[model samples]
Target: MHSYGQFCGLAKGLDVIGDRWTLLIVRELLIRGPCRYTDLCTGLPGIPTNLLADRLRDMEREGLVRREMTPAPTPAAVYALTPRGEALETVIAALGRWAAPLLANPHKDDVFLPHWLVLPARLYLIDRSPRQAPVRVEVRDGDHRVTLEAARGRVSARVGPAEKPDTVIIGQTPIAWQLLLGKIDLAQARKAGLEIQGKTTALKRFGVRPPTKAVFISP
Candidate 1:
C-alpha cells in the first residue's frame, strides 16, 4: 500500500484501504455481517486465496476488522467489521451512486451479485420512493433475498425476508441488476419470462413504471 505522506484525512483513510480488493472485502463484510473465511471467498469470486489471507491480516492490524472464534453448531472462526469499519457504509453507498452509470455498459470481466443491487436501490430507487413500507425482494437462483425498508428520506437493506412485503420481485441476478439501474423495466422483463408476484403499481413509489403492454389484433 502506498501512502501520500501528507497530513490529510482522506489520505490517511486511503492508506489503510486503498488496495484493489480491500474495500470490496469490506463491502461484503458490511452486507453480510461476520463472514466465515470460506463465505468471503465464495462471495468474492476470482480472488486469490493467498491475497485474501494477506488482506485479512492487514485489515485486522488496521483495526478495520476482527477475527473471532465461535462455538455454535460446532467451533468456527468468523471475521467481522470493527466500529471503524462499519463507518464506511456511507462511503460505499456514495460509491454505488457514483458508479450507477457504469452499470449500463457492463464489462466482460465484471461480475454481478443480486445483493449488490441493494445499495443503488437504497440510494436511487427507494430514497425517491413515495411509499415507506418494508419490501421483501427475492433474487431467483441465489441466496440474495433482502428486505428494503424506506424511512426518513432514505432506504436500507437487510439480508433475508421482510415480515410483509407490498411487492416481491423474482428474477436472476442480471435482471435484478438492470431493474435497479433503471436500464430495464420490470413489466417488460416479466413479459419475457421474468417472474414477479404482487402489485405492479406498488413500485411506482420507487420510480418503476412497468412498460405499457402492447396488444395486437390480426385479421
Candidate 2:
C-alpha cells in the first residue's frame, strides 16, 4: 500500500504491487488458479503467516483479489485473482524472461518446485513443428515430475505425469534445464546424469536445438 505520491502510470502500479511477496502471490494464483490459504502457503516458501494474511487483506481492498466459498461436500473458501489482477500476466511474464539468466546457477539451498518450471517452459519452448502431432515430454527430477506439451506452435506445462508422453527426460533439475534450453546436446546431457527415452524427435519439435545467436543461451 506504500506509494511514492506520484501520478505516473508505472509509479501508480508500483503503489499497489511493489511490496515484498506481492507479485509472487500473484504468481501462485496465476499458476495454480483458485486455491485455499494453505495452498498459497505451500507455494510460497518463507512468507510469514501474518504477512500473507495482511497482504491478502490489502489486495482484497485494492480489488486485485477475491475470496469465494465453495459449495457441497468439500466446501471451503478459495482465493483467486480479480480481472484487474489477472491483467498482470504480461508484466510477470516479461519480468520472468528478463530475469531468466539469473537462474543459470542456483544456490545449493535454494528451494525448487516442479510446477515452477511451467512459466519458463512456456516462454522457451516454442513449437517448431505445428503440423505434427502433439509432443508430450515428461520431465523427472528427483521425486518431482512435470509434463511439457507442444502443439500448434505453442507449449504448455503442468506438474505431474503425462497421460501418454512422447518423450521422457530424467535428470536433476539443473541438467534438465540445460537440456531443454539447448545449453547441452542430448549426448552431453546423458553424460551429465541425464536420461532420455521414447521419441528423440519430440525434443526437436519442442525447439530444443544447438546454441545459436538467435537463442537465449544461459551464461
Candidate 3:
C-alpha cells in the first residue's frame, strides 16, 4: 500500500500494481483473461503457493479483480479483471513490445520465453491457422480451450483436446520464438524426424511468416 504523492498518476497507478508479483499476475490475467487460481500458479513458474494466495487476496481487496463462483458443488471461483484492471492491458502490451527483442535470442536462457510468448501469441494469433479450418494442438502443460474440426485441408488452430493433429507442437520454449529465430525451420524440423504426423497439406498451414519489419531479441 505504498503511495506516491497525490499528483503523480503513474506513481499512484503503481501503488496498486507496483508490487513485485502484482504486475506479473495482472499480465497473466490480461493475456489469458479469466483464470482459476490453479491456472495462475501453473502458468507462473517459481511463485510460491502462499505468496500467490496472498497476492490474489490483495488484488481482490484493491478492486483490480472480481472473484465469481463457478457452478461446481465445491464452490470454485475464477478471477477476472474488473474494468479498472482491464485498463492495464495497453500498458502490458507496451511492456511486451519493449521486451520482445530481449527475448528473441536463441542462446539466452529459455526460462522466460513461455511467459513472454503467452500475450503476443494471443495478440498476433500466432498459433492460429488461416489456411485450414480446424487445427487442434495440446501443449502438455498449457491451457485448454476447445477442440477444432477441419476438413482434410483447411487452416485453423484450436487448443485443447483432439484425436490427433497433423503436426503436434510441443515445447515450454516460446513456440513463436522458435519459429521466428531460425533455430529450426518447420519443414527442416519435420524432415529431421520431429514428432510431426498427418497430412502434409494440413501441416503446411501452420507455417510461420513473421512480419518482415518486426524487431526481436538477439541472443
Candidate 4:
C-alpha cells in the first residue's frame, strides 16, 4: 500500500523502492541476476529474516520480482526481476557511480575488506579489466579455500578446495584492501612481510591497479 501521492515521476519511482534496504536488494539482483532466498541473505548480511521476507513479498506485489517454485521434490523457490524490475539496473548503476567517491576515501578506519573478495574465493573469477577474461585464482589460508573465474567482463567466486593458481596473495584484510586499491604497492607490501607466494608471473598478473583518484566518502 505504498503511494506517491502528488510527487513527481522520479519521486514516485522512489516511493516504490525508496527504502534503504529495497534499493540494495535490487542492486544485488541486478548485478548477480536470479538468486535463491539464502543466496540473497548471504550477499546482504545483517538483514533480518523477517524483514527480508516482508520485503520480498512487498516487491513481488509491486511487480518488481517474480518467484518460481523449483522442480525439487521438496520444492524451493527462486526470485528474479521482471522487465520493470530489470529497468532499475540503470538507476542502480548510476547510484554506484555517484557513491564511488565515498568508496575511495582511505582515511576511513572503518574500512573493512569486502567479504566479496575473501570467503569463497575458489569459486570466483576476478577481473581487473572490463575487456579481459577473469584470471583464475585460488586462495587458501589454513582450511579455508576460495576459487575465482573471470571472463567476458564478469567475475564469479565460489568457496572450495582446488589446485593452487599462478599466484597466492597473503596478507591481512587491511593490507589486502590497500594492495587491491593501489594505496600500497606489492613490493612495499612484500617488504612489510606480507606473503606473496606462487609464481612470480602470477603475482604480476594478480596485481590490481589502484584507482587514480578515489571518490571520497564517509563509511
Candidate 5:
C-alpha cells in the first residue's frame, strides 16, 4: 500500500484502503457477506484473476479481511470482512450517498448492475406508514428484479421477485431509482414508460418528503 506520508487519520485510513479495487472488494464482501473467490469475480466483472488474489492478500495482511473454509460435503473457501473491515460501512455508505446525484447523468457506456440498487434502496426507502401493515413492492428491470418490503417501521430490500407483491414497478432501473428518491411522481414516471400495478399507495408508504424550510428568527 502506498502511504500519503501524513500522520492524519484520513491519510492513515487511505493508506490501507486507497488502492484500486480495494474498496470495491470491501463493497462486495459487505453486500454478499462471506463469498467464494468465484463469487467475488462474478460480482466484479472485468477484474483480472491475479489482481483479485493480490488485493485479497493485501487486505488479509492489513487485517481487513479473512478467509475461512466451509463445512465438508461441498466445502469451499470464502472471504469475509474482519470487524475492522466492517467498520468501513459508514465510509462506503457516505460515498454512495455522495454519488446519488451522479446517477442522473450516467455515461452511455456505464454498466448498470441491478444488485447495486440495494445500497440506495436501504439509504432512501423509509416506512412513512409504519403503523400500517407490511407492503411488498417488487421492482423489475429486464431480468433483474428486487423486492422492497416495508413492515413494522423498517424497510428491507432483497434480490428476487416478491412471492406476493402488493405493488409492482416495471421499468428501467434508473427510472425506478428516481421514483424512489421522490424526484418524480407516479404520473411523470408513467410518462417515462414505467408501468405501475396494484396498490399505488404502497409506494407512498416509503415516502421521501421534501425538505422543510427553516424559519428565520429576528435578532
Candidate 6:
C-alpha cells in the first residue's frame, strides 16, 4: 500500500483505494452484491489469493467492507459493502463513463468480465420510451445472468436472476454490447445464434438504432 503523508482528502482517499486493484475489488463487491471469499477470487480473473485477502482486510479496516453471516437456506460468511462503500457507485459510474472510449478497442491482453458491462450498460442505456413502465432485461451468457431494470429515469443492473424479466437477451458479451450500442441489430445478433425472447419492441429501448452497415469483429 502506498501511503501519502499529505493531509488532502483526494490523497487520503487514494491512500485507501488507490492500490492496484482495491477499487476493482470494490467494483466486484458492488456489482455482485454480497460475495464469498472464493466468489471474489473467481470473479476477478488474475487476482492472487493473498493479495485479495490483504485488500479485503485493508478495506474492512478502512470502513469500506464488512463481513456478514448470511442466515437461512444458505448460511455462510459473505462480504458486503458498507454505506461508505456503496457511495462508490457514483464514483464507479463516473469512471466508467470516462473510460468508455477505451472500450472501443481493447488491447490484446486486456482481461474481460461479463459483469463489467453492468456499469456501462446502465450508463449508456438509451431509453426512448415516453412512459417509464419499469422495463426488465435479463442479459444471459452461458450460466451467468445479469438483470437490468430501466425505469424512473434510471437504469439499474444486478448480477443474478431477475424477479420477472420482460425481455431476456441471451448473447455473447461483446456482441450484446455492440447490439445494445446500435453497432448491430437484433437480426444480426439472432443470426449469430443469440436467443432473445419476450417484448421485443420494448427491448429496443436498450439498444441504439441499428446501423445501416453491420460492423463485424474478426476472429
lDDT of 2 at 151: 88
Alpha-carbon deviation at 158 in model 3, angstroms: 7.8
Query: What are the per-residue Cα lDDT tens digits for candidate 2 across 1-219?
Result: 789999899999899999999999999898878889998999999999999999999999999999999899899999999999999989998897677657656566778766677767766668888988889999987777889998887888877789889999987766677677776899898998888989987888767422322222222
Task: List the pairs of residues colliding in candidate 6.
Answer: none
lDDT of 3 by residue, 104-178 (tens): 455654345244444554333343355546655433224433332334443233334567654444433343334
The per-model lDDT (C-alpha) reads: 0.69, 0.82, 0.60, 0.60, 0.82, 0.78
The local lDDT score (0 to 100) that residue 134 gets in candidate 3 is: 64
Better of 1 and 5 by lDDT: 5
Clashing pairs in 1: none
lDDT of 5 by residue, 1-219 (tens): 789999999999889999999999998887768999998998888889999999999999999999999999999999999999999989997887666556555566666676666766766677888889999999998888888889998888877789899999998877777777676899999998899999998888886433311111111
For candidate 3, what is the total of clashing residue pairs? Answer: 9
Candidate that scores best on TM-score: 6
Prediction 1 global C-alpha lDDT: 0.69
Which 10-residue span in candidate 4 carries the lowest summed lDDT? 116-125
TM-score, per-candidate, Cα-based: 0.80, 0.87, 0.66, 0.63, 0.83, 0.87
Residue 156, model 2: lDDT of 88
Worst 10 residues of 6 by lDDT: 210-219
RMSD of 5: 6.5
Where model 4 places Cα greater than 4 Å from the true spot, the runs are 31-33, 104-134, 138-165, 168-177, 190-219
Model 3, runs deviating above 4 Å: 31-33, 104-117, 125-159, 162-166, 171-177, 180-183, 190-193, 200-219
